[model samples]
Target: MDRDDETSSTPPAPAAPARASRSRQLRLAALLLLLVVVVAATVRVVVATGPPTWDELRERAGLTNRDRLIIGVKDDQPGVAQKLENGAFEGFDIDIAYMIAEDLGFDAPEVTLLSIESEDRARRQARDADGSFVTVDLVVASYSITEQRRDQGVTFSFPYLETEQSVLTLASDPRQVASLRDLERAKVCTLGTSTSEQRLREAGANPIGRNRISQCIQALYDGEVDAVTTDAAILAGFVGPRPPGELPPATKLLRPKELRHWDIGAESAEKWGVNTGPVPEMRDLVNLSLQQSAKGPDGDRWKAAFDRYLASEQQYSNPQQVAVGRQPEPEETVEVRQWPWERWALPSPGRPRSGVPSAARAPSRRNRRSSGC
Candidate 1:
């Protein structure tokens, strides 16, 4: 009869054990909430004072706030160099660089000219270790793309211009020299350490190397070398009619079938070129600038400058120019510090193929005399 009362009186000893387990679980939950709060606060602090990337500092420190951009250029061609004069820096390469800088917020960039020789470009770029010269952000020289250069840690951008290799020969020569094989019997001269020389060697031409293109041209003129082998662009500048007797009438530029294909592009690399370190972000930024310049106003401006210089050489009149592209518009205004061509006397148009030359001359009657030559 007392069994129910006895069970009730014993009470549940297991209840005390259950309450103790619940208390332990609650303590663990509170500890986990505290840890989560600490982690959130730490992340917020880190986000507020973000770590600076090497590229951000390098670009900001090197590039000033005043829209000043310094570019490297070769000092040889007057026409091309002239574009960089006056605030314009307007050559194809110069225009491209200026446009990139402008798009990056450096409008009216202050261009500081750096002289780069065809041979010494690699070495000069390698001079970053010594800190003797200011590191050039970009090089706008008429640089060619080559495989040997790729090994030197220089990266190349997409090609913006195409050119060919050709021989600038005496018009009097009757020999039908059209390919590198033809050069086996011909004495060929080229600038030392030039891509022309490299290509010739690759083709088994075995040409004599001169110090510069001017010297190579002179060697050809003196009969020391049968022909001057170089990029057609440079040869065009040399053979095109100059202010009267500057170039002889007998000098004729010939682009043989074999030595007729090269491309011009920007160069940079991981160690020696534009990319000196492991900063992919910087490389990307520079590449973007180059691409923008190639597409927009900068591209147009560069084409005009390139055309103006090339036109003076009369290179664009040939079939190759037609094959590649048309000349840039002449009416376009280009920026420059001074008009270098203003004082030079340009030859009056020879009788046009028809009456067009004469008609064109009529309009330039005052312009020719007023050119301040």
Candidate 2:
């Protein structure tokens, strides 16, 4: 073979540095693509697992749009829930409303208490101080949780208070009303659309429906009705304090001395719950607040409220029955999802964990802890 043919057959070698540079550039490009994919996947996972924001919680609880929380409460049901002369509400129900509102991130001033009648409770419509009708976020009135009420679109939290039917009559009246049967064929005044009215009908009493319990009380005083029937706690409020000096100004007109309290002695109890109206999401939030109140170390709101409003009235009411006014153990379980930072921020065992999804199934009656009321 000729030297020229041999030289043409062999290709010239490229520079080593140039070859190395091209190889390095390919590897670097692959690494950068891989890094981008990894970062994107990590960001997606974190977002999906992250804890809910405060605004999200309020939105889910159906209170995001409103700056203040409006609660429906009874203005006339004296120790259970009543309006004071200073235009403030003070009572057990009012205290309970405060507890729930605090848990919901509202201050005392951010809560608006509106007067709600028994019939309007299910509708969540309350009358403001100016007599305008406003929709309430919650009904902390002496609202009983019944299956029928649930069917009617009222979603309630777990029971907070358990009471039984009671009758209040004029002390001067000769009727000895120890049980429901004693009121048979007699005209009894009860709030319309109330559990007491149904019970009165079952006991063969003629129930006259009124807009408010106060109206029933007035009817009883005016000799228009034989007695006013409702929960014992409410009746005890009408009776006021046993001591003359301790008599609440609101009850002075009721003439506590002339009011007679009769324990109806029923087997089943009226389990009072916070009415959430049509919002089912509010149920768990309310249940958790109540659970904290009953069990948490930092949560003595329920006990304090009971002592302040209902404790002293036990003298005029049924001591045994009134003793059961203790706060109920929440029946439902609450689960919350939180970030590591959130857990570290709130280390107290009493603080409710936030953001975790709860169990969907309701606890069976057999598995539920009894409130002993």
Query: What lDDT would each prediction earn against the true structure?
Result: 0.46, 0.72
Tell me the RMSD of model 1 versus the true structure.
17.2
Question: Per-residue lDDT tens digits of candidate 2, residues 1-373?
Answer: 9999999999778799898999999999999999999989986786677544444656787677767888998877766776645566667788788878777766676778888888888889988768989999899998888899989888889899987777888889997987888999999999888888888888899999988777788778778889988777777776643333222324234322367778767777888999976655576677767877777654666886787777767766653355365777788666455556765776322244342111211111111111011
Best by TM-score: 2
Q: What TM-score does candidate 1 get on C-alpha atoms?
A: 0.54
For model 1, residues 1-373, the per-residue Cα lDDT tens digits are 4999888788555687789899989999999999999988976775556543323533554543444555565443323332222222223344444444444345442445455455655543412324456556556566665677768755554444555566656666666555666667567898777676766676667689875565666566567777777665555544433343221222222332212222222122111123212344444445444443354334564455445454444432254331123322222222212122431432111001111122211011110100001
Q: Give candidate 2 regions above 4 Å deviation.
A: 1-55, 62-66, 242-257, 347-373
